[model samples]
Target: MFARRALLGLAAALALSTAAPAQTQAQTQAQAQAPNPRVRIETAEGPIVLELYADKAPKTVANYLKYVDRGLFDGASFYRASKPPGYAPNDYGVIQGGLQNDPKKVLPPVAHEPTTQTGIKHVSGVISMGRHAPGTAQADWFIVIGDQDYLDADPKDPKKTPGFAAFGKVVEGMDVAQTILGKPVDPKAGTGAMKGEMLVKPVRIVRVRRVQ
Candidate 1:
């Protein structure tokens, strides 16, 4: 009877040990699948709240958060609004902001997280990184004005062009986003890729912060 009792006790101990790890794994998976982080970007027009897809674009989200934490976007301006005439063929485009390659405000580039990999699309109100080339994105980002699936990675030939990294979307203040999109652009101000796209009076970014 003593031996049988000891065996039962040992079996119970083993069962507990096994259950502990399974419980921990279940908790970890639940945390991983939790709701993504949210942030509020206060601009002169209004406050645009964005919900970032940390699970899909972890690195991109982290990089953006770093800038927000450091107050890098304060006083920044939405300097470009790429619209119909400014960016022909692509009727609906984006409102570009952040450092704008200022060198003074630019942070080091983060690794590109292509839409093909993240499974995020560049739909209206979607926020995406702006880069001269893959792996060159730093502080610059854009908010899509309308359905812009062309910004997504071409599944047929993703190797040639990975497309932009879309990390989040405007949860509120899209009307403000459209207001910025309709702002006046300088006909003779910008050069090269930015020609005719530069805003004559860029909208100011008052501040950006994380919110519950």
Candidate 2:
């Protein structure tokens, strides 16, 4: 009788262990298949909707979600506007923003996700992260207002050359990013920035959160 009861308990436990993961997997699949999480970045000009591509770039998405979850991006401002050095300032338009208002929330760098691996193009209005001198990209990211082919990983030199990892595109807010790029700035002024401390206007990221 004891042996039979033990066997029955073991079988029940085993069945539960197996079923639990299956249920969890189904739940996860339901969430993953759900609509992509959307975030609206309210800027000085208008609001821009950014559809985060977590499925495509897991690391990048997870890193960005860390920022959002911590409320680090709220009330932050974009302070750097680099005109890509000599390209007529307007040609290579870019606006840098993220978790700058509060230095306390700047998280450490996560693993880098290269464009080649991500398969995401660096087209206009695509938002990406900027790494430190070497492999040290923190929470600092930028919005591309124009085609950024230079940002793509060099095919010939693959992993050697640093490539900007693109995690998401501005699905409904290209106009906002464009408005930011079009904002006038002193080309001769504001060279390389240690932080995003040179963005011309007070282009602020009002908030960064999942569209719940």
By TM-score, the best candidate is 1
Tens digit of per-residue lDDT, candidate 1, span 1-212 = 99999999999999999999999999999998799999999999999999999989999999999999999999998999888754543346799999877888777899999988999999999999999889999998999988989889998899797899999999998888888888888889898878999999999999999987
TM-score of each: 0.86, 0.78
Clashes of each: 0, 2
Which regions of candidate 1 deviate over 4 angstroms? Answer: 1-19, 86-91
Candidate 2: worst-modelled 10 consecutive residues by lDDT: 188-197
Question: Candidate 1: what lDDT?
Answer: 0.90
Angstrom error of the Cα, residue 156, model 1: value is 1.2
